[model samples]
Target: MNRHGQRIGEPASRWRMQIVPIATVMIASALPLMLPLVASSPVLPPLGLLFFLSWQLLRTEMWPVWIGLPLGLWDDLFSGAPIGTAIALWTAASIAIAYLSQRIYWRGFLHDWAIGALLVAAVQALAVFITFPHAPAGHMLGLVLPQIIISVLLMPLFLRLTGKFDNFRLKRR
Candidate 1:
Protein backbone atom coordinates (compact mmCIF):
# COMPACT_ATOMS: atom_id res chain seq x y z
CA MET A 1 0.00 0.00 0.00
CA ASN A 2 1.12 3.56 -0.48
CA ARG A 3 1.13 4.63 3.13
CA HIS A 4 2.01 1.30 4.77
CA GLY A 5 4.41 0.04 2.10
CA GLN A 6 2.72 -3.35 2.00
CA ARG A 7 1.09 -5.38 -0.67
CA ILE A 8 -2.66 -4.83 -0.79
CA GLY A 9 -5.23 -7.47 -1.61
CA GLU A 10 -8.43 -9.24 -0.62
CA PRO A 11 -8.25 -11.84 2.14
CA ALA A 12 -6.71 -14.98 0.67
CA SER A 13 -9.23 -17.30 2.32
CA ARG A 14 -12.79 -17.21 3.64
CA TRP A 15 -11.53 -18.16 7.08
CA ARG A 16 -10.41 -14.63 7.72
CA MET A 17 -13.97 -13.33 7.55
CA GLN A 18 -15.15 -16.06 9.90
CA ILE A 19 -12.61 -15.18 12.55
CA VAL A 20 -13.54 -11.53 13.00
CA PRO A 21 -17.27 -11.94 13.74
CA ILE A 22 -16.77 -15.02 15.92
CA ALA A 23 -14.24 -13.19 18.02
CA THR A 24 -16.48 -10.13 18.15
CA VAL A 25 -19.54 -12.08 19.29
CA MET A 26 -17.58 -13.93 21.93
CA ILE A 27 -16.29 -10.69 23.33
CA ALA A 28 -19.78 -9.16 23.26
CA SER A 29 -21.19 -12.24 25.00
CA ALA A 30 -18.53 -11.95 27.69
CA LEU A 31 -19.44 -8.35 28.43
CA PRO A 32 -23.08 -9.26 29.06
CA LEU A 33 -22.00 -12.18 31.24
CA MET A 34 -19.62 -10.02 33.26
CA LEU A 35 -21.54 -6.76 33.55
CA PRO A 36 -23.49 -7.68 36.68
CA LEU A 37 -20.27 -8.11 38.58
CA VAL A 38 -18.52 -5.09 37.10
CA ALA A 39 -21.05 -2.29 36.90
CA SER A 40 -24.30 -0.79 38.06
CA SER A 41 -25.98 -0.68 34.70
CA PRO A 42 -26.75 -3.73 32.61
CA VAL A 43 -24.38 -4.75 29.86
CA LEU A 44 -25.07 -4.37 26.15
CA PRO A 45 -27.18 -7.27 25.03
CA PRO A 46 -26.89 -9.43 21.88
CA LEU A 47 -28.46 -6.94 19.49
CA GLY A 48 -25.01 -5.95 18.30
CA LEU A 49 -24.37 -9.51 17.19
CA LEU A 50 -27.66 -9.46 15.36
CA PHE A 51 -26.69 -6.22 13.68
CA PHE A 52 -23.30 -7.66 12.82
CA LEU A 53 -25.11 -10.50 11.12
CA SER A 54 -27.09 -7.97 9.12
CA TRP A 55 -23.89 -6.22 8.14
CA GLN A 56 -22.52 -9.53 6.89
CA LEU A 57 -25.74 -9.97 4.97
CA LEU A 58 -25.25 -6.62 3.28
CA ARG A 59 -21.63 -7.30 2.43
CA THR A 60 -21.28 -8.75 -1.06
CA GLU A 61 -17.72 -9.98 -0.67
CA MET A 62 -18.38 -12.26 2.33
CA TRP A 63 -21.10 -14.81 2.78
CA PRO A 64 -21.26 -15.82 6.42
CA VAL A 65 -23.17 -19.10 6.23
CA TRP A 66 -20.33 -21.16 7.68
CA ILE A 67 -19.84 -18.73 10.54
CA GLY A 68 -23.52 -18.89 11.49
CA LEU A 69 -23.54 -22.53 12.62
CA PRO A 70 -20.63 -22.31 15.03
CA LEU A 71 -21.65 -18.90 16.31
CA GLY A 72 -25.17 -20.13 16.87
CA LEU A 73 -23.84 -23.14 18.76
CA TRP A 74 -21.78 -20.83 20.90
CA ASP A 75 -24.79 -18.61 21.52
CA ASP A 76 -26.95 -21.60 22.42
CA LEU A 77 -24.40 -22.83 24.96
CA PHE A 78 -23.73 -19.41 26.36
CA SER A 79 -27.25 -17.94 26.40
CA GLY A 80 -29.08 -21.00 27.79
CA ALA A 81 -31.35 -21.14 24.78
CA PRO A 82 -32.62 -24.44 23.45
CA ILE A 83 -30.04 -26.35 21.40
CA GLY A 84 -29.90 -25.22 17.76
CA THR A 85 -32.48 -22.54 18.47
CA ALA A 86 -30.26 -19.52 18.17
CA ILE A 87 -28.59 -21.07 15.19
CA ALA A 88 -31.93 -21.53 13.52
CA LEU A 89 -33.04 -18.01 14.34
CA TRP A 90 -29.80 -16.40 13.26
CA THR A 91 -29.72 -18.40 10.06
CA ALA A 92 -33.25 -17.36 9.25
CA ALA A 93 -32.48 -13.73 9.92
CA SER A 94 -29.34 -13.88 7.81
CA ILE A 95 -31.33 -15.39 4.99
CA ALA A 96 -33.94 -12.69 5.26
CA ILE A 97 -31.25 -10.00 5.27
CA ALA A 98 -29.62 -11.50 2.24
CA TYR A 99 -32.92 -11.53 0.38
CA LEU A 100 -33.79 -7.98 1.36
CA SER A 101 -30.27 -6.83 0.62
CA GLN A 102 -30.86 -7.35 -3.07
CA ARG A 103 -33.47 -4.57 -2.97
CA ILE A 104 -31.71 -1.98 -0.82
CA TYR A 105 -28.35 -0.30 -0.72
CA TRP A 106 -27.76 -1.03 2.99
CA ARG A 107 -25.00 1.53 2.86
CA GLY A 108 -26.33 3.49 5.82
CA PHE A 109 -24.96 1.69 8.85
CA LEU A 110 -27.26 3.39 11.37
CA HIS A 111 -30.40 2.82 9.40
CA ASP A 112 -29.54 -0.78 8.72
CA TRP A 113 -28.70 -1.39 12.36
CA ALA A 114 -31.93 0.18 13.54
CA ILE A 115 -33.79 -2.10 11.21
CA GLY A 116 -31.77 -5.05 12.53
CA ALA A 117 -32.75 -4.16 16.10
CA LEU A 118 -36.38 -4.21 15.08
CA LEU A 119 -35.86 -7.62 13.52
CA VAL A 120 -34.09 -8.88 16.62
CA ALA A 121 -36.87 -7.69 18.88
CA ALA A 122 -39.59 -9.12 16.69
CA VAL A 123 -37.83 -12.46 16.20
CA GLN A 124 -37.08 -12.83 19.90
CA ALA A 125 -40.66 -12.09 20.81
CA LEU A 126 -41.95 -14.58 18.30
CA ALA A 127 -39.50 -17.22 19.46
CA VAL A 128 -40.60 -16.85 23.05
CA PHE A 129 -44.27 -16.68 22.17
CA ILE A 130 -44.24 -19.98 20.32
CA THR A 131 -41.73 -22.04 22.31
CA PHE A 132 -42.42 -20.82 25.84
CA PRO A 133 -46.09 -20.11 25.93
CA HIS A 134 -46.24 -20.05 29.69
CA ALA A 135 -43.88 -17.13 29.89
CA PRO A 136 -45.61 -13.78 30.26
CA ALA A 137 -45.49 -11.47 27.25
CA GLY A 138 -44.88 -8.61 29.64
CA HIS A 139 -41.45 -9.93 30.47
CA MET A 140 -40.37 -9.77 26.86
CA LEU A 141 -41.49 -6.16 26.48
CA GLY A 142 -39.92 -5.12 29.75
CA LEU A 143 -36.55 -6.76 29.17
CA VAL A 144 -36.17 -6.92 25.43
CA LEU A 145 -37.58 -3.59 24.36
CA PRO A 146 -35.04 -1.50 26.22
CA GLN A 147 -32.23 -3.73 25.06
CA ILE A 148 -33.37 -3.33 21.46
CA ILE A 149 -33.41 0.43 21.86
CA ILE A 150 -29.94 0.42 23.33
CA SER A 151 -28.64 -1.84 20.63
CA VAL A 152 -30.08 0.37 17.90
CA LEU A 153 -28.46 3.38 19.48
CA LEU A 154 -25.07 1.73 19.71
CA MET A 155 -24.90 0.10 16.29
CA PRO A 156 -23.75 3.02 14.14
CA LEU A 157 -20.50 3.60 15.99
CA PHE A 158 -19.64 -0.09 15.98
CA LEU A 159 -20.42 -0.55 12.30
CA ARG A 160 -18.42 2.50 11.38
CA LEU A 161 -15.38 1.32 13.32
CA THR A 162 -15.56 -2.21 11.98
CA GLY A 163 -16.00 -0.93 8.44
CA LYS A 164 -12.93 1.22 8.83
CA PHE A 165 -10.95 -1.63 10.29
CA ASP A 166 -11.95 -3.93 7.46
CA ASN A 167 -10.91 -1.31 4.93
CA PHE A 168 -7.62 -0.79 6.71
CA ARG A 169 -6.90 -4.50 6.86
CA LEU A 170 -7.82 -4.94 3.22
CA LYS A 171 -5.51 -2.14 2.27
CA ARG A 172 -2.69 -3.63 4.30
CA ARG A 173 -3.06 -7.00 2.69
Candidate 2:
Protein backbone atom coordinates (compact mmCIF):
# COMPACT_ATOMS: atom_id res chain seq x y z
CA MET A 1 0.00 0.00 0.00
CA ASN A 2 1.11 3.50 -0.68
CA ARG A 3 1.24 6.26 1.92
CA HIS A 4 -2.40 6.96 1.17
CA GLY A 5 -3.17 3.42 2.16
CA GLN A 6 -4.85 2.72 -1.15
CA ARG A 7 -4.43 -0.51 -3.11
CA ILE A 8 -1.26 -0.75 -5.20
CA GLY A 9 -3.34 -1.14 -8.38
CA GLU A 10 -4.26 2.49 -8.10
CA PRO A 11 -1.72 4.95 -9.37
CA ALA A 12 0.15 6.49 -6.47
CA SER A 13 0.57 9.69 -8.35
CA ARG A 14 -1.06 10.87 -11.58
CA TRP A 15 0.21 14.44 -11.49
CA ARG A 16 3.38 13.19 -13.17
CA MET A 17 1.39 11.93 -16.15
CA GLN A 18 -1.16 14.72 -16.42
CA ILE A 19 0.73 17.97 -16.66
CA VAL A 20 2.01 17.83 -20.23
CA PRO A 21 -1.27 16.68 -21.69
CA ILE A 22 -3.21 19.49 -20.01
CA ALA A 23 -0.65 22.06 -21.03
CA THR A 24 -0.66 20.73 -24.57
CA VAL A 25 -4.40 21.29 -24.87
CA MET A 26 -4.17 24.78 -23.44
CA ILE A 27 -1.35 25.77 -25.78
CA ALA A 28 -3.00 24.24 -28.78
CA SER A 29 -6.12 26.29 -28.06
CA ALA A 30 -4.29 29.54 -27.43
CA LEU A 31 -1.70 29.46 -30.19
CA PRO A 32 -4.18 30.20 -32.93
CA LEU A 33 -5.35 33.21 -31.02
CA MET A 34 -1.82 34.55 -31.19
CA LEU A 35 -1.24 33.76 -34.83
CA PRO A 36 -2.70 37.05 -36.06
CA LEU A 37 -0.13 39.03 -34.06
CA VAL A 38 2.94 36.85 -34.49
CA ALA A 39 4.35 37.19 -37.98
CA SER A 40 6.35 33.98 -37.82
CA SER A 41 5.11 31.75 -35.06
CA PRO A 42 6.21 28.11 -35.19
CA VAL A 43 2.84 26.81 -34.12
CA LEU A 44 0.47 26.46 -37.01
CA PRO A 45 -2.29 24.26 -38.38
CA PRO A 46 -2.45 23.01 -34.79
CA LEU A 47 -0.65 19.84 -35.82
CA GLY A 48 2.15 19.93 -33.32
CA LEU A 49 -0.24 18.81 -30.63
CA LEU A 50 -1.65 16.27 -33.04
CA PHE A 51 1.81 14.84 -33.56
CA PHE A 52 2.47 14.84 -29.86
CA LEU A 53 -0.81 13.08 -29.18
CA SER A 54 -0.04 10.64 -31.98
CA TRP A 55 3.18 9.73 -30.24
CA GLN A 56 1.20 9.02 -27.11
CA LEU A 57 -1.27 6.95 -29.10
CA LEU A 58 1.50 4.51 -29.91
CA ARG A 59 1.64 3.54 -26.28
CA THR A 60 -0.42 0.50 -25.37
CA GLU A 61 -1.64 1.83 -22.06
CA MET A 62 -2.99 5.17 -23.28
CA TRP A 63 -5.59 6.26 -25.81
CA PRO A 64 -5.50 9.46 -27.84
CA VAL A 65 -9.29 9.67 -27.93
CA TRP A 66 -9.22 10.46 -24.25
CA ILE A 67 -7.46 13.73 -25.00
CA GLY A 68 -9.10 14.44 -28.34
CA LEU A 69 -12.43 15.82 -27.14
CA PRO A 70 -11.10 18.60 -24.94
CA LEU A 71 -8.34 19.49 -27.33
CA GLY A 72 -10.82 19.64 -30.16
CA LEU A 73 -13.21 21.79 -28.19
CA TRP A 74 -10.36 24.10 -27.37
CA ASP A 75 -9.39 24.27 -31.00
CA ASP A 76 -12.96 25.00 -32.00
CA LEU A 77 -13.21 27.81 -29.48
CA PHE A 78 -9.87 29.36 -30.32
CA SER A 79 -9.98 28.68 -34.01
CA GLY A 80 -12.73 30.23 -36.14
CA ALA A 81 -13.85 26.84 -37.26
CA PRO A 82 -17.33 25.45 -36.55
CA ILE A 83 -17.86 24.34 -32.99
CA GLY A 84 -17.43 20.62 -33.48
CA THR A 85 -15.42 20.48 -36.65
CA ALA A 86 -11.96 20.34 -35.13
CA ILE A 87 -13.29 18.03 -32.48
CA ALA A 88 -14.56 15.57 -35.07
CA LEU A 89 -11.33 15.66 -37.00
CA TRP A 90 -9.13 15.23 -33.96
CA THR A 91 -11.29 12.44 -32.60
CA ALA A 92 -11.08 10.61 -35.91
CA ALA A 93 -7.33 11.00 -36.11
CA SER A 94 -6.97 9.75 -32.57
CA ILE A 95 -9.00 6.69 -33.44
CA ALA A 96 -6.78 6.06 -36.42
CA ILE A 97 -3.69 6.34 -34.25
CA ALA A 98 -5.17 3.95 -31.75
CA TYR A 99 -5.85 1.38 -34.45
CA LEU A 100 -2.39 1.74 -35.89
CA SER A 101 -0.80 1.79 -32.47
CA GLN A 102 -1.20 -1.93 -32.07
CA ARG A 103 0.68 -2.67 -35.26
CA ILE A 104 3.71 -0.40 -35.11
CA TYR A 105 6.55 -0.03 -32.66
CA TRP A 106 7.57 3.53 -33.63
CA ARG A 107 11.04 2.50 -32.49
CA GLY A 108 13.34 5.50 -32.72
CA PHE A 109 13.44 9.27 -32.46
CA LEU A 110 13.73 9.65 -36.22
CA HIS A 111 10.87 7.25 -36.76
CA ASP A 112 8.65 9.19 -34.37
CA TRP A 113 9.58 12.40 -36.14
CA ALA A 114 8.74 10.96 -39.51
CA ILE A 115 5.43 9.62 -38.32
CA GLY A 116 4.64 13.01 -36.81
CA ALA A 117 5.35 14.77 -40.09
CA LEU A 118 3.20 12.46 -42.13
CA LEU A 119 0.39 12.58 -39.63
CA VAL A 120 0.52 16.36 -39.53
CA ALA A 121 0.29 16.41 -43.30
CA ALA A 122 -2.60 14.04 -43.19
CA VAL A 123 -4.37 16.15 -40.57
CA GLN A 124 -3.92 19.27 -42.65
CA ALA A 125 -5.27 17.59 -45.74
CA LEU A 126 -8.17 16.14 -43.86
CA ALA A 127 -9.04 19.44 -42.20
CA VAL A 128 -8.92 21.28 -45.46
CA PHE A 129 -10.98 18.71 -47.25
CA ILE A 130 -13.57 18.93 -44.56
CA THR A 131 -13.67 22.69 -44.19
CA PHE A 132 -12.92 24.19 -47.58
CA PRO A 133 -13.33 21.78 -50.38
CA HIS A 134 -13.57 24.57 -52.95
CA ALA A 135 -10.37 26.35 -51.95
CA PRO A 136 -7.75 26.63 -54.68
CA ALA A 137 -5.32 23.78 -55.00
CA GLY A 138 -2.37 26.15 -54.86
CA HIS A 139 -3.75 27.78 -51.75
CA MET A 140 -4.18 24.47 -49.99
CA LEU A 141 -0.77 23.25 -51.06
CA GLY A 142 0.84 26.55 -50.13
CA LEU A 143 -0.48 26.46 -46.60
CA VAL A 144 -0.10 22.75 -45.90
CA LEU A 145 3.39 22.23 -47.31
CA PRO A 146 5.09 24.82 -45.14
CA GLN A 147 3.22 23.76 -42.03
CA ILE A 148 4.05 20.12 -42.65
CA ILE A 149 7.71 20.86 -43.24
CA ILE A 150 7.98 23.04 -40.17
CA SER A 151 6.13 20.52 -38.07
CA VAL A 152 8.43 17.75 -39.27
CA LEU A 153 11.54 19.76 -38.53
CA LEU A 154 10.44 20.91 -35.12
CA MET A 155 8.77 17.70 -33.93
CA PRO A 156 11.94 16.09 -32.58
CA LEU A 157 12.81 19.13 -30.55
CA PHE A 158 9.28 19.61 -29.26
CA LEU A 159 9.07 15.98 -28.28
CA ARG A 160 12.35 16.29 -26.46
CA LEU A 161 11.13 19.31 -24.54
CA THR A 162 7.80 17.77 -23.61
CA GLY A 163 9.39 14.43 -22.85
CA LYS A 164 11.53 16.15 -20.28
CA PHE A 165 8.36 17.01 -18.37
CA ASP A 166 7.99 13.27 -17.64
CA ASN A 167 4.22 13.13 -18.02
CA PHE A 168 2.02 10.34 -19.36
CA ARG A 169 2.30 6.61 -18.78
CA LEU A 170 3.35 4.38 -21.62
CA LYS A 171 3.29 0.72 -20.83
CA ARG A 172 6.34 -1.32 -21.66
CA ARG A 173 5.85 -4.40 -23.70
Candidate 3:
Protein backbone atom coordinates (compact mmCIF):
# COMPACT_ATOMS: atom_id res chain seq x y z
CA MET A 1 0.00 0.00 0.00
CA ASN A 2 1.10 3.54 -0.72
CA ARG A 3 1.41 6.16 2.03
CA HIS A 4 -2.29 6.94 1.84
CA GLY A 5 -3.22 3.32 2.48
CA GLN A 6 -4.00 2.57 -1.14
CA ARG A 7 -2.88 -0.68 -2.77
CA ILE A 8 -0.84 -0.12 -5.91
CA GLY A 9 -1.08 -2.51 -8.82
CA GLU A 10 1.62 -4.60 -10.49
CA PRO A 11 4.90 -2.98 -11.41
CA ALA A 12 4.05 -2.92 -15.09
CA SER A 13 0.81 -1.05 -14.56
CA ARG A 14 2.53 1.49 -12.41
CA TRP A 15 5.21 1.93 -15.02
CA ARG A 16 2.71 2.25 -17.85
CA MET A 17 1.71 5.75 -16.78
CA GLN A 18 5.26 6.99 -17.12
CA ILE A 19 5.26 6.53 -20.88
CA VAL A 20 2.00 8.37 -21.47
CA PRO A 21 3.45 11.82 -22.10
CA ILE A 22 6.25 10.83 -24.46
CA ALA A 23 4.08 8.34 -26.29
CA THR A 24 1.20 10.77 -26.73
CA VAL A 25 3.43 13.65 -27.80
CA MET A 26 5.31 11.47 -30.26
CA ILE A 27 2.04 10.31 -31.77
CA ALA A 28 0.66 13.87 -31.86
CA SER A 29 3.81 15.04 -33.61
CA ALA A 30 3.07 12.72 -36.52
CA LEU A 31 -0.50 13.83 -36.97
CA PRO A 32 0.18 16.71 -39.36
CA LEU A 33 2.24 14.45 -41.56
CA MET A 34 -0.54 11.89 -42.04
CA LEU A 35 -3.21 14.37 -43.07
CA PRO A 36 -5.28 13.52 -46.13
CA LEU A 37 -4.97 15.74 -49.17
CA VAL A 38 -8.14 17.63 -48.41
CA ALA A 39 -6.85 18.85 -45.06
CA SER A 40 -3.35 19.60 -46.29
CA SER A 41 -2.62 23.27 -45.70
CA PRO A 42 0.36 25.19 -44.58
CA VAL A 43 -1.90 26.96 -42.12
CA LEU A 44 -2.67 23.82 -40.13
CA PRO A 45 -1.33 24.26 -36.61
CA PRO A 46 1.57 22.06 -35.54
CA LEU A 47 -0.22 19.49 -33.47
CA GLY A 48 2.92 17.96 -32.06
CA LEU A 49 4.21 21.20 -30.63
CA LEU A 50 0.75 22.05 -29.35
CA PHE A 51 0.55 18.75 -27.53
CA PHE A 52 4.09 19.04 -26.25
CA LEU A 53 3.51 22.48 -24.79
CA SER A 54 0.21 21.37 -23.28
CA TRP A 55 1.82 18.39 -21.60
CA GLN A 56 4.75 20.40 -20.38
CA LEU A 57 2.60 23.14 -18.90
CA LEU A 58 0.14 20.75 -17.31
CA ARG A 59 2.64 18.33 -15.78
CA THR A 60 6.10 19.78 -15.74
CA GLU A 61 7.54 16.94 -13.66
CA MET A 62 6.57 14.26 -16.14
CA TRP A 63 8.71 15.74 -18.94
CA PRO A 64 12.38 15.76 -18.22
CA VAL A 65 14.92 17.78 -20.23
CA TRP A 66 16.42 14.82 -22.08
CA ILE A 67 13.16 13.58 -23.59
CA GLY A 68 13.05 16.63 -25.87
CA LEU A 69 15.87 15.32 -28.05
CA PRO A 70 14.20 12.08 -29.05
CA LEU A 71 10.81 13.69 -29.37
CA GLY A 72 12.28 16.48 -31.48
CA LEU A 73 14.08 13.90 -33.59
CA TRP A 74 10.81 12.07 -34.08
CA ASP A 75 9.18 15.34 -35.13
CA ASP A 76 12.05 16.09 -37.47
CA LEU A 77 11.72 12.72 -39.16
CA PHE A 78 7.98 12.92 -39.71
CA SER A 79 7.40 16.66 -40.18
CA GLY A 80 10.03 16.93 -42.92
CA ALA A 81 11.59 19.84 -41.07
CA PRO A 82 15.29 20.35 -41.64
CA ILE A 83 17.37 17.96 -39.56
CA GLY A 84 18.27 19.32 -36.11
CA THR A 85 15.85 22.22 -36.40
CA ALA A 86 13.20 20.60 -34.28
CA ILE A 87 15.91 19.28 -32.02
CA ALA A 88 17.12 22.74 -31.10
CA LEU A 89 13.70 24.37 -31.04
CA TRP A 90 12.01 21.63 -29.08
CA THR A 91 14.75 21.53 -26.50
CA ALA A 92 14.71 25.30 -26.20
CA ALA A 93 10.96 25.42 -25.82
CA SER A 94 10.98 22.73 -23.16
CA ILE A 95 13.65 24.58 -21.25
CA ALA A 96 11.74 27.84 -21.58
CA ILE A 97 8.59 26.24 -20.20
CA ALA A 98 10.52 24.77 -17.31
CA TYR A 99 11.98 28.14 -16.50
CA LEU A 100 8.60 29.79 -16.73
CA SER A 101 7.09 27.23 -14.39
CA GLN A 102 9.77 27.98 -11.81
CA ARG A 103 9.46 31.75 -12.09
CA ILE A 104 5.70 31.78 -11.78
CA TYR A 105 4.28 30.43 -8.56
CA TRP A 106 0.65 30.89 -9.56
CA ARG A 107 -0.82 30.03 -12.97
CA GLY A 108 -4.17 30.19 -14.64
CA PHE A 109 -5.72 29.35 -18.00
CA LEU A 110 -5.17 32.86 -19.32
CA HIS A 111 -1.51 32.77 -18.40
CA ASP A 112 -1.04 29.42 -20.03
CA TRP A 113 -2.91 30.57 -23.08
CA ALA A 114 -0.73 33.64 -23.46
CA ILE A 115 2.47 31.67 -23.01
CA GLY A 116 1.28 29.00 -25.41
CA ALA A 117 0.44 31.62 -28.01
CA LEU A 118 3.79 33.30 -27.75
CA LEU A 119 5.69 30.02 -27.88
CA VAL A 120 3.69 28.77 -30.83
CA ALA A 121 4.24 32.03 -32.67
CA ALA A 122 7.94 31.97 -31.91
CA VAL A 123 8.31 28.40 -33.13
CA GLN A 124 6.41 29.12 -36.29
CA ALA A 125 8.48 32.22 -36.98
CA LEU A 126 11.74 30.42 -36.37
CA ALA A 127 10.77 27.51 -38.58
CA VAL A 128 9.80 29.84 -41.38
CA PHE A 129 12.92 31.94 -40.98
CA ILE A 130 15.11 28.86 -41.07
CA THR A 131 13.33 27.35 -44.05
CA PHE A 132 12.74 30.51 -46.04
CA PRO A 133 15.21 33.09 -44.98
CA HIS A 134 14.57 35.32 -47.97
CA ALA A 135 10.80 35.13 -48.05
CA PRO A 136 8.97 38.45 -48.14
CA ALA A 137 7.58 39.75 -44.86
CA GLY A 138 4.05 39.96 -46.20
CA HIS A 139 4.18 36.41 -47.50
CA MET A 140 5.56 35.10 -44.23
CA LEU A 141 2.84 36.81 -42.25
CA GLY A 142 0.18 35.43 -44.52
CA LEU A 143 1.43 31.92 -44.04
CA VAL A 144 2.11 32.03 -40.33
CA LEU A 145 -0.64 34.23 -38.90
CA PRO A 146 -3.39 31.71 -39.44
CA GLN A 147 -1.38 28.99 -37.79
CA ILE A 148 -0.60 31.15 -34.79
CA ILE A 149 -4.20 32.18 -34.34
CA ILE A 150 -5.43 28.62 -34.62
CA SER A 151 -2.85 27.34 -32.21
CA VAL A 152 -3.67 30.00 -29.64
CA LEU A 153 -7.37 29.37 -29.99
CA LEU A 154 -6.85 25.66 -29.56
CA MET A 155 -4.71 25.92 -26.45
CA PRO A 156 -7.67 25.56 -24.10
CA LEU A 157 -8.89 22.49 -25.93
CA PHE A 158 -5.47 20.90 -25.80
CA LEU A 159 -5.19 21.66 -22.10
CA ARG A 160 -8.51 20.00 -21.48
CA LEU A 161 -7.44 16.95 -23.42
CA THR A 162 -4.14 16.75 -21.56
CA GLY A 163 -5.99 16.95 -18.29
CA LYS A 164 -8.12 14.03 -19.38
CA PHE A 165 -4.99 12.07 -20.21
CA ASP A 166 -3.58 12.92 -16.81
CA ASN A 167 -6.75 11.68 -15.21
CA PHE A 168 -6.40 8.42 -17.08
CA ARG A 169 -2.77 8.05 -16.11
CA LEU A 170 -3.42 8.63 -12.44
CA LYS A 171 -6.55 6.55 -12.24
CA ARG A 172 -6.41 3.60 -9.84
CA ARG A 173 -6.19 0.30 -11.58
Give per-model CA RMSD.
Answer: 3.7, 5.1, 3.3
Residue 163, candidate 2: Cα error in Å is 0.8
Tens digit of lDDT per residue, candidate 3, span 1-173? 88865686633346558877777888898887677645334777788888898988898878687667888889889877788778888889889999999999799989988888888889878887777788897788688888889888998899899999878787666
The full ranking of all candidates by lDDT, starting with the best, is 3, 2, 1
- Clashes in model 2: which pairs? 17-168
| Best-performing candidate as measured by lDDT | 3
Against the hidden true structure, what lDDT does model 1 obtain? 0.60
lDDT of 2 by residue, 1-173 (tens): 65756665665256546555566657756766766556442336564365445446434354446566877787778766667777777776677666666677555766666766666677666666666678897777676677667766777766666565444342111
Top TM-score hit: 3
Off by over 4 Å in 3: 1-12, 38-41
Q: TM-scores of all models?
A: 0.73, 0.72, 0.88
Tens-digit lDDT string for candidate 1 (1-173):
45765545634335554555556666664555655455333345574365356456446446555555666677777665677777777777777776667777645756577667666766666555655667788875665566666666665666666676455434423
Candidate 2 regions off by >4 Å?
1-12, 35-60, 64-66, 167-173
Q: Report model 3's TM-score to 2 decimal places.
A: 0.88
Cα deviation in Å at residue 85, candidate 1? 2.3
Q: Measured by TM-score, how close is model 1 to the native structure?
A: 0.73
Report the C-alpha displacement of residue 75, candidate 1, in angstroms. 1.3
Global lDDT of each candidate: 0.60, 0.62, 0.82
TM-score preference between candidates 2 and 3, better one: 3
Candidate 1, residue 119: how far the Cα is off, in Å: 1.9
